[model samples]
Target: MSQKNSEGKRSARERLQEQRRKEESRTKRKRTLIAAVVVVAVLGAGAGIAALVAGGGSDKKKTAGPLVAPQGATGKDTVTIPVGKPDAKSTLTVYEDFRCPGCGQFELGFRDTIRDLEAKGQLKTDYHLVTLIDGNLRGSGSLNAANAAACAQDAGKFAAYHDLLFKNQPQETDDAFGKKSRLIELSGQVPGLDTPAFRKCVEDGTHDSWVKKSHEAFSKSAYHATPTVLLNGKDVYGDQKNPLTPDKLRQMVTANAKG
Candidate 1:
C-alpha cells in the first residue's frame, strides 16, 4: 500500500510541473502578437499623416501666381529712361522742367501709373524736357542738367541716369550747379557700364543737338507749360484740372493704341 501511494504522489507532481510550463509558453505568444499589432498601427498612422502634409504642400504650390517688381519698368535702356517700358503702344510726350514742382508731382503720378500698364505693353512715353526749370532752381537753369542727361544717353545709360536724377533731386536753393555735379556723380554708380566714357560724353555735350531740337519742338507746340503733356501726339496736361489720373491715362492709352 505504501509503494502505490508513493508512485501516485510522484505522477501528480510531474503533471503540475507540465501544466505550469504550458501556461508560460501561451503567455509569451500572446505578448508577441500584441507588440506586432501596436507597431503596425503606428506605421499606418504615420503614412496617413505624411499623405495629408503632401497634399497641403501641393495646394500651396498651385495657389502662387506670377511675380512682379515694385516699379514695373523693365530695367532696360531702350528709351534712355530707366523706369519706362519700351514696347508700350500709346506714346506719351512730356515737356518737363527739372526744377518744377508740378513736374515732380507728374513724375510720381506718371511712374505709378506706368508701372501697372508697362507689363501689358499699353503705354509708351517720351520725355522731351525743356531747360525752363534749371536757372531758377536755386537760381540756375536746367541747361547743365540737360547737358548731363545728354551725356548719360550717349553712354547707353540715359534711362538709368534720368531716373537717378529725378529720384535724388535736391531741394531748390541757390546752388543748382552743386546739385548738377551730384547728379553726374551718381551716373558713375550704375553697374556693367563705363563711367569714364559716360562722363566724357556729358562733358562734350553729346546730346546737344537733340536737346536743342526738343526745345524747338516745345516752342512750336500749341502748349506752353512746365508739364506740357501730349497724349498720342496732342497737347493735354498743364491745361486740364485733372492732369494725371490713372483711369484717364488708361483710357487715353487704350484709344491711342487702337488708333
Candidate 2:
C-alpha cells in the first residue's frame, strides 16, 4: 500500500509538471502571435504614412469640375504673361518654377534685361510656370505659389506678383508658400491686387488644376530644368559652350527681331 501510494504521488507530480510545460508552451505561442500582429500593424501604418506623404502630404488631388484656365493662357498647358506689346516681333518663352532657387537666380540676373526689352516692345515673354520642385521637395509650396500667381493673373497683377514670388522665395527646402494666407499676404504688397476676388481665388486654389496641366506640358517638353529660356523657340541656354548673358539675351532678341 505504501509503495502504491508513493507511485501514485510520483504520477501526480509528473502530470503537474507536464501540464505546466504545456501551459508555458501555449503562452509563449500566444505571446509570439501577439508580437507578430503588433509588428505587422506597425509596418502597415508606416506604409500608409509613406504613401500619404508621397501623394503630396495633405494636399488631395483636385477631383472636380473643368479646369479653369488663368488669364492670358495661351494653351491649356501655359499662361502667357505678356511682358510687351501683343505685336512684338520676337517671343521669349521662359519656363520657371517659383520655388526653384536657380530660377530665382536667373530672374535676378535677367529680369532687368528682359523688362527693358519688353519695354522697347522688342520681345514678348511667355511665362510657363511649373511645379516640379514641389514634387521633388515633398511639399505643396510650389503648387500653391503657382496657383497664387495664376490668381494674380486674374487680377492683372501677375508680373508684379511673379517678381515678388521670386524675390522673396525662401530657401529651396523651405516651404513658405504652403499656406494660402502667405500668398494672399504677398499679394497685398502689390498695389491694387488685394481684392476680394483675388483672395477667394488664392484661398480656393482656383487655378490648381491649371497649374498641374502646365506642369504636364513642361514635363513633356524637350527643354528640361527650371528657368529654361527659349528665344524664337530655340533654347538659349542649351549651349554650354556659349552660355547666355544679359547682353547675350539682348543681342539674341535683337537679332531675332531683325530676322
Candidate 3:
C-alpha cells in the first residue's frame, strides 16, 4: 500500500506487456517468412512441370522415323505431289490437311474447276499435305489419310483418291481415316488403285514419314491454317475479306494461262 510498492507493481505490469508484444511480433515475422517460402516453392514446381511438358513434345518430334519420300514425290524434300501437267503455264500451290473441314470444303468446291483446268493444260497444281488437325485434336486421322493419299499418288490415282477422301471426310473429332482398312476400302473405288502395292503402302505407313516431313515444313512456314492456296506464289486463299471462289480461281488461271 506504500507509494514505492505501488510504483514497483506498475513497473512490473508494463514490462510484462512489452514482453508479450515482442513475442507476438516475432511470431508474425516467422509466419510471413514461411508463407514466402511456400510461394517460391510452388512457383518453382510449376516451372518444372512446364519444362517437362515442353521437353516431352520435343522428344516425340525427334523420334519421328527416317524420312521416306513417297514414290514420284517432287519439290523440296520430295513432299510435293504434282497433279497436273508439268508444262502447264499456271501453278497452284495447295497446303491441306485431310481432317480439316475447311480443306474438305475447298476441295469439294474446286475439284471440278481444278480438274478442268488440268485437262486443258492451263494449270498445274502442287499439293502439299499436312496433319494439323491430328496435332490439334490428338488423333492420327490426318496423318493416316495423308499417307494413303501419297500411296494413291504412287498408283497414279492421287487426284481421284484425293477427291474421294475429301468427299468422304468424317467429322473432325472422328478418327475414321486412321484405319488402314478404311483407306483401303475407299481405294477399291478407284480403278487399279487397290493393288497389293497400294495395300502394302497403306498398311505399312510407307509415306507417313514423308507426310510428317511435309507437316513440319508447313509448321515452320508463315501459314498457320489449312487450305492455304497460292497462285503463282501469291496468297489467293486465307484472306477472309477477299475469299477465293471456284469462279475466281478459274478466271485467275485463265488470265495467267499462256498460248
By lDDT, the best candidate is 3
Residue-wise lDDT of candidate 1 within 1-259, one digit each (tens)?
Answer: 6999999999999999999899999999999999999999999999976764464221112121222111222222222233346667776776776666677677777766765665577876666656655434423335446656666555566556665666666554433433444555677666633476665544544544545455556667676677777776776675457665767888878776687
Q: How far off is residue 99 in model 1, in Å?
A: 2.0
lDDT of 2 by residue, 1-259 (tens): 6999999999999999999999999999999999999999999999987785676534444332358888777744455556677888888888899999989998999899988999898989889888888879768889889988988888887888999999899999988887778888988899999999998887777888888888888889886798898887888876779889999899878987787
How far does residue 181 in candidate 1 sit from its true spot (Å)? Answer: 3.1
Off by over 4 Å in 2: 1-65, 76-79
Q: What is the per-residue lDDT of model 3 for residues 14-66, given as tens digits with 9 covering 90 to 100? A: 99999999999999999999999999999999998777556532112323356
Best by TM-score: 2
- How close is every model to the real structure, measured as TM-score? 0.57, 0.76, 0.76
- For model 1, the superposed segments whose C-alpha errors exceed 4 Å read 1-87, 135-141, 174-180, 254-259
* Candidate 3 or 2, higher lDDT: 3
Q: TM-score winner between 1 and 3, please give it.
A: 3
Ranking by lDDT: 3, 2, 1
lDDT of 3: 0.87
Question: Model 2 — which ten-residue stretch has the worst lDDT?
Answer: 56-65
What TM-score would you give candidate 2 relative to the actual structure?
0.76
Candidate 3: residue 255 Cα off by (Å): 1.2
CA lDDT of every candidate: 0.59, 0.84, 0.87
Where model 3 places Cα greater than 4 Å from the true spot, the runs are 1-65
